[model samples]
Target chain A: MDDMTTKDVQEPYTKHLLHYFDGTSRYVLIKDEEVPFPEGKLIVSRTDLQGIITHCNQAFIEMSGYTEEELIGQPHYILRHPDMPKVAFKDAWDTVGSGVKWHGYVKNLRKDGRYYWVYATIILNIRDGKPVSCTSVRRKPSRTQVDACTALYAKLRQAEEE
Target chain B: MRYVMTVSPDFPPGQIAGWYIFNTWLQRQLGEHIHVELYSDFEAQRKAIREGQIDLIYANPFDAAMLVREEGFTAIAAPLSKPDEAVIAVAVDSPIQQVADLKPGTRIAATDDPDVNLISMIMLEPADLSAQNTQTQTVGTYILVAKQVLQGKADVGFFLKDAFAGLSGMIQRQLRVLVRSEIHVIRHVLLVGPRLRERHGDLWNLLSEMGENDKGRDALKNLGLQGWEMQTQEDTEFMIDLMDTLVN
Candidate 1:
């Protein structure tokens, strides 16, 4: 609450109208302005089996628009944009469960209801021969990658809604 | 209580069994149930570290900083006389004699070995080449990096100095070393996390005396190491500080 920055969003706010996998959807404003991902910096985070954030690096905190104290112990879907198709996370969980790494271009919503695109790679963390958690590192995706993901995600989102 | 020990993944395929032998020797000498878990890359290994899954680790110089500072891993020892080094090379026929001959748009093929890539990038600073300016291609292996340079697909290749030396003689003759990092202070170190803190002293003493016995000496040879060099906390902090400086 105190850590969140409620930036002034001029774009009219819109509701999901139909929602799933999103928990406690507080910020409903979807600004058309995109926050540019910083160069030469990596956003890294770790989550428990339930996808609750356990640790986050400074770069992640800066880009995510949420303070460190607020982010930890919260579900990672806090950054989930309604525009993101649920299938992306479903595919991630399905593949990562098999000890495989998953990589995709994603548009993550910031605390201010702004968005940024990243090339994210996630891997399963194992303990005593058992899977325990997940670690993800993300970097700025190229313009071409962002453009392609935008088109593909739009189609996927439309399909999910219909 | 079974502890999990992991090694850096950059070791040669020939050294896979060597690690197992070393692990077996460690368990026998320490009188503990220690299992070896092998991760194919740094991402997985780092994840395990963050998740508190790894108890003991043989880490690269780049990761040593994170392990000690971030994960509370205490440094114990390093392979005697083995310093991890990096080399940047070009094809023998290429006119690039020194690193300064490199240009901004030069295509550089490299592996994801963080220490090697970090030092190699610093070396390229003299030539005004950088990740922002250079066309960098990440190959799967050192040999593939060499292949990229030899086939003129990349103007330069970055490699682990040891891996480059391990290349076949025929291939070695085809490439020329542009520059090799001489930061001799950096080396792979064995570290124990908080869970294994109590056994650190016993483990260090055993490694120090490992060379006295034939079986222990044999295990060392299998891992391509001579002996163990005992490390103090000061030694570790200095090295990690150096690595932090270099990384920035």
Candidate 2:
């Protein structure tokens, strides 16, 4: 261990971090509350290349139950509800990472531990012909949509864990 | 990686050879494999851009606005002191001498060059003319617009100032300028995508001072440029804001 080489030091730590963060949340809590997403209002948030939140609109703050100051510098995955299949976010990253738009039903955890559902569309904000950031616009999802995604995500999460 | 460079089709046909020579200069200056690809019209060029096929471009003001905002293009430089302006004209033999004489049904010829059209429409406001009151016939090029006015198919024609200048002297003699826009801030710009960003600083240095050298001056002459001037993000953002205001 004392004779660890430069190549060994760089390779292991890099691969280790990638595995730890991939589709993983930093924290989670559960509470018996469900917040209703107001109709006709869009919830928008912008994140940097690494998925750190940069900007958020008023609807995002209200839906997430977080203040603007608290939300700006956090990882967007802070809202990763336990019910959401990690593969859903992985798919979102894969699509937007390749400079394509991603559309999906997302269940998000609020600051107080309640959950809300949204129909989300994600796109990259480009500069110098490279994607530098991402913007996600969310709208209210129908009850039918939420129920379908809920059932589908449960099956996916079970398959992933097994 | 191989890179593609393109220009707005609005450039005069006389400058086609000039651009090939300039492309050669760019390759030598950057020491990279850059290929030239030109489109016949704005629609085709925009299609290529959206598909992410272009690595660098010398774009018109209107398309430049879209590139900066919608696409991930960075503006590097623009032609020094060469702001784009619009010109409105009538045939030398036309009975209408001024805009004031223009009637509600006056026939107008125009191209879809957005910036020029915006300014041209504003100039027509003095005559109580508008999209509803005036008759507009969209043509393929400034040349066709000029031809329509000369043949009396249209009583008036709209052209970008440089495109009008590119017309032959005989065409110039046959037309009378009703007015020309003096908005001195809008111009064509050179931009690069992320692929060529590594050369951004060096490209700017070479371009901003190219007018001082002998070979560069020859290339500039072919493109009708005096020199390249530095364009920052703020400069481009300001112009985009102005265009949005005009559009709204």
**If you score just chain A, what TM-score does every candidate get?**
0.88, 0.83
> What do the candidate models score in CA lDDT, each in turn?
0.82, 0.79
Candidate 1: residue pairs that collide? none
lDDT tens per residue, model 2, B39-94: 98889999999998998999988887779777878889988889889899999988
Mind giving the per-residue lDDT tens digits that candidate 1 earns over B1-248? 98999998888779999999999999999999999999989899999999999999999889997898789899899889988888888999999987656777999999878888987886776455668999999988899999999999999999998999999999999999887766566789999999999998999899999999998999999999999999997578656645654553
TM-score of each: 0.61, 0.59
lDDT of candidate 2 over A71-111, digit per residue (tens):
88888876777777778988999998997778888998776
Candidate 2 lDDT score relative to the true structure: 0.79
Off by over 4 Å in 1: A1-162
Docking class of 2: incorrect
| Segments of candidate 2 deviating more than 4 angstroms | A1-162
